[model samples]
Target: MDHMGADPDPDGRTAREQLKSERERDARRRRARRRFSVVGAVVVVAAVIGTVFALGGAAEDEAEGRPLVVPANTVGEQRTSVLYGKADARHTLSVVVDPRCAPCARMEAALGRAMRQLADKGAYRIEYRLATVEDDARGGKGSRWAVNALGAAANEGPEKFVRYLDAVLAGRSGREEWDGDALASPETLLGIAGRVDGLRTPAFDKAVRELTYLPWAKKVAAAHNQNGDEDALPAVTLDGSTVTVLGDDGVPVSPGEFIRQVRGDKG
Candidate 1:
């Protein structure tokens, strides 16, 4: 009868209870290990994504630090129709002209010297845009030759181009015969180029004779047409805004007054 306490669980109930508790503990540990593994995987994925974004951001920053470059379409082989000026200049003077336009010729004649002087003084940067408005209208035979010749001259150097332009405009005066047979003829243009020192190269001659730059001339004209009203042959813009030239007398000013106005020396 005293063996009652020792034999109370002779069926092994206490041992079974201890075994169940051990199994439950093992299950909890397994679940904890799985949770740690999931958390570690999530952290690794987040780090990878962060690294990718950081690299992308650095590339964008590098691009932003570079200097601005003009688009190629806006520039020609010899920088024809391209904006010309000091990079830090405060004002931009853009002149769109046609070789055969009488008004353009007159403007060039009147303002050529002043424009050159102002350009040399760094008063404002000047850009020349060529167009064939009259020539193209006259069956593409009027000023195409002259326009192409200008492009060829530009290929040599900007100085040479300016000299050649001055010569061309100077020739236009009192030459009522400048229309059909005389506009930049092979002999005429080469003669003009010859006057400018170092501009009458054999390559330049070949380009002019072969109309090598006619296509580019057409493009420049098209650009001019698209940028301004159709009737505005000699479209002039200051810093991309169209402006009118007026004299102190309240009348439309001549080219010289226009230059002075652009220089801020005249109203």
Candidate 2:
């Protein structure tokens, strides 16, 4: 009794319904994505604003009265490990990173680029330290790799450490490893470490195994996370007083703005 002219086939109704369902599902995903983007943007803006206020010293909303950031100066602390810039530069960037956290890799890239740009202009130098956070739920193997590799690099020179670190952040040995074969084993890590100049020696391999510098590692971790010191990774302190930027929330504050504000650059 079906009207032949109204329908081409009996399955046409089912096919139309399926297509409608798929369309609705896709539309929901798009809406979800848009909402997330908007929320993320707002959070970043708020964090940047907070940074500007904190660094700029706008006393209008000074609730905590501008907290001070204490400098880390332990006997075991090396000059190169204090900040993330070239040697002999005034300013320092001590970055706390967890190898398992993907964002740490991104921040490392950004920080490296920032240092190169500054160095080219004779503006500033950054000292680097690869420290681990206690809250890092992962086995901290990546932190260990960084500490060991950096220690190896430090033995050779800061430049070599920087080069090796650049490789580590860029997935040179595969960033995502569940079994930890890429960085957990001394042989595998030492192989990569040997490629860096100054560290390709039997003595270098032995020093890495000895890990004489691990106490320094613990001190660096404590410096940033001390009681009431709430600064997080990707966070930059200017002149040991101002919190210029926080990378924890993915804000995109320009480096120029940061330098001008933190270094008191009039230009």
Candidate 3:
């Protein structure tokens, strides 16, 4: 109509003004895309960093002559876990957890007995992969300390290790919050170990106090990251497949259902 078509967008702006507005809109969109990309990248990087430092990886774990040691009864080629059940159990149930995660403690409390019974029956071998993300998130060494305690417990024996885990993690459930500072004290773990018969010995006391298995704990924490769920605590997998043992709100399902899920019944 009027040579340049009535200001292009019909907003009454001049052609030049309309062009400038479109340019600005495009720039805003570009910035939004950049922000989304940065956010995605940040999430991945944060997970890696969190896992590393959670187990005291930020500090030197293996100093000059300090060698990496695996716990006595740990399984797998990497030997990064405390194993429960027969070595040739029909199924392998791997649990990824953090000592300070309330949900993790809750899950263990709710289903711990059932888990042990199954392991006793040779239904599955429970591989507990401990993570230390809480130490990084909460700004203390409690998670690392707890993991170290478990490592020492495993060295005593898998039975003792499993007993210690059942006692400590199960006991921590329903607490309002984890006292990282309090747990950082060696006495906390030592106190809990006292409940597990034969768990408290001079060797275990020395290991708990000096973090004898800290490097092994670090490796176990790192090994869990390979699962690629960002080390979400209280997560369970059966023979390498994830099982939904807990609801979205962190409440575990009925013990029967948990067993069924592990047995491959989703319905």
Candidate 4:
């Protein structure tokens, strides 16, 4: 698989991470030269570097023989994705994201509400593809750990999972950038879970701590690597084609505009 975790940068960063960092620094330099002439350009560029779902124990977790705790109502051979919206909804909007990716956070901060409103209005369903590439890039396990926590939330049903997912992205953290150290902590995961109504149950907390869904999290990352030419994290795809949510000026098109664009672009 052509995963970002493949090639190592000299400083031990993964290729994607290195490239993303370089791009960001370069963008900053260019912005300074242009005297902040085009702030929108950076937003669009940052958005594309945003997603990943990659790793685990002994296959990383494969050799452990722990029972895979699949989320309820998810699809695919590995049961990847958190299924949301009406099954019969006329369209599917696939959103890829990662826990510690700063771009993913900004993407969420920018248009998450619009997407949810559309989903609620039956404009389209959403399949959240959570990635762990950030974990691999940084030699941290927070991405997989976060996904495992998500699995615990999903076990209770989509509503819990959805609320918990949003909370993890922003809930009580009350910040923009992700605190990777906090994400790596099971107690932090539990604390985020506590913000979701009825999600911080004993079983849910146990699963997050013990990583009952670790196997599935790995599967999701593997499948992510094997499947598509990754369009980037925090990406949006409709009818199997990538869609740009923000305009050239870096502003999100209104929810109405988004729907019209998707409808026009449907393959």
Candidate 5:
């Protein structure tokens, strides 16, 4: 009698394989989670430092219910990287964000909603300057994707930019991770650029190649991370002066109220 037992159930083999694969996958996931958690902790620490120093200025704004508006002239000819609306708005809001940072996405949504409201009311002259605060040294794929996407939108024009931003920010929570070609490819960035109407393919390709904002983005990170806080995204500056951090719970401050305050609206 053959001791091989006539080829034991295929189901058993399949189950064993599945179990082993699952264990390997689980281990990989665990390692990834650990890495992310470590990175998060470091970013959080940096954010705390930034928040503390930033509090000096922010506290003054809260105390006076007004912050000294730094003239755009002070920032000089350097156009801010994050412009939310048309270039010629009565008020310009400069924002800094990180793609993986949830709060920043919420702020983007709020700003979009606010702009839509204003547009519906025939008050669409608000300029938005969006900058990224991701440290290239630390941000991994998500940050790169965000930077590239932002550049893609800006190069294409605000309409496409806004649309794409809304899509990514809106759907960020469902995204599994920032790995693979989606975040890593220049072509992916260009594909996003292509979504913009009338974007010349050569220009888009050249823009990606040049990466004009790469340096500016680093500058932005340094400016925002002046005191080394890397914890928050969607740091907001109204009219190039006021800095508002998304509250601890991550709900954004009311965009309506912010606009009103910026406009000195009494009503």
Candidate 6:
């Protein structure tokens, strides 16, 4: 009856075996695909994490590298009084100064170098408190603008601010007509600031041109007058005590003596 060709495996064992092999092959392919997907996802996540960390590190580095200009004791809550030198210094020399005042200029010319030396030696730290008494008294905005400019330069860094202040002081003779007119225009102030290294940044220039710090300057002056004698400019204080340049003999101390007195080396 040709049974050999009709029913080679009565239970269909060959077909069953082929079906089982196909199922095994399919299972292996699915496992390989799942492993590949998991590995790819892990790699993608690692790459994204690595890129974020690299960018975050670069941003931190940029922030740390840029110089900071601090405006202390102004209208804001983050006010700082450190114009120069270390904030945690043992001795503090707080000087209330007017940019347009002749006496302030003379005081700076005499003691500027010495004060810087003292600060460098870590003997004392200097805090320059800005005041616009001259402008208020003169009925003009010159002192305010000048102070604003100085404050703007301060944004560059304390050293640049000091340099800008020095440049302004150098051109003054204490007379209102000369000092006021010389610094009346933004161009004049910008010109002076341009000479100082790192002081002529776009932000600084914008502040000077737009009078961005005028409000802060006004607040500083108001605060100064409220705290101390309004008429006095270039007032020096050593360790919270007022230091008069004039000695017991009513004679002004020399620049060297001034440094010595500030350093507690009067002997």
Off by over 4 Å in 5: 1-76, 84-88, 116-132, 136-138, 141-145, 171-182, 191-200, 209-213, 226-231, 240-247, 253-267
Candidate 5 per-residue lDDT over residues 8-99, each given as its tens digit? 65565665777898899999999999999999999999999678557533532342343322212113244435444444555555555565
Residues 170-227 of candidate 2 have per-residue lDDT tens digits of 5522454334424544566676665566666775676555443444444455554553
Q: How many backbone clashes does candidate 6 have?
A: 3
CA error at residue 239 for candidate 3, angstroms? 1.0
Q: Write the per-residue lDDT of candidate 3 for residues 2-61, one digit (tens) a residue.
A: 685555656678878877999999999999999999999999999986875664443334
> CA shift at 200, candidate 1, in angstroms?
0.5
Pairs in steric clash, model 4: 51-233, 52-131, 53-131, 53-132, 54-132, 56-60, 56-61, 57-60, 57-61
lDDT of 3: 0.79
Best by lDDT: 3
- Encode model 1's per-residue lDDT on 1-267: one tens digit a residue: 475546356665687787898899999999999999999999999999788557534533543354432222234344557444453567667777777666666666666666667666776777888777775565534465677788788777767777787777666554543655366456778887888999888888887766666666656666667766565456677777765542334344566566656756323
The global Cα lDDT (0 to 1) of model 2 is: 0.53
Question: Model 4 off-target regions past 4 Å?
Answer: 1-63, 171-176, 246-257
Error of 2 at 230 (Å): 3.2
Candidate 5, residue 85: how far the Cα is off, in Å: 4.1
- Cα RMSD for predicted model 2: 17.0
> Candidate 6's residue-wise lDDT over 117-200, tens digit each?
778778777888877888767765668778878888777787887888888887764432354345656788898887898788
TM-score of each candidate?
Answer: 0.61, 0.53, 0.72, 0.69, 0.51, 0.65
The residue-level lDDT of candidate 4 at 49 comes to: 39
Flag the better candidate by lDDT, 1 or 5. 1
Give me the runs in candidate 6 sitting further than 4 Å from their true place.
Answer: 1-82, 174-179, 246-252, 265-267
Q: For each candidate, how many residue pairs have backbone atoms clashing (under 3 Å)?
A: 0, 8, 0, 9, 12, 3
TM-score order, best first, reads: 3, 4, 6, 1, 2, 5
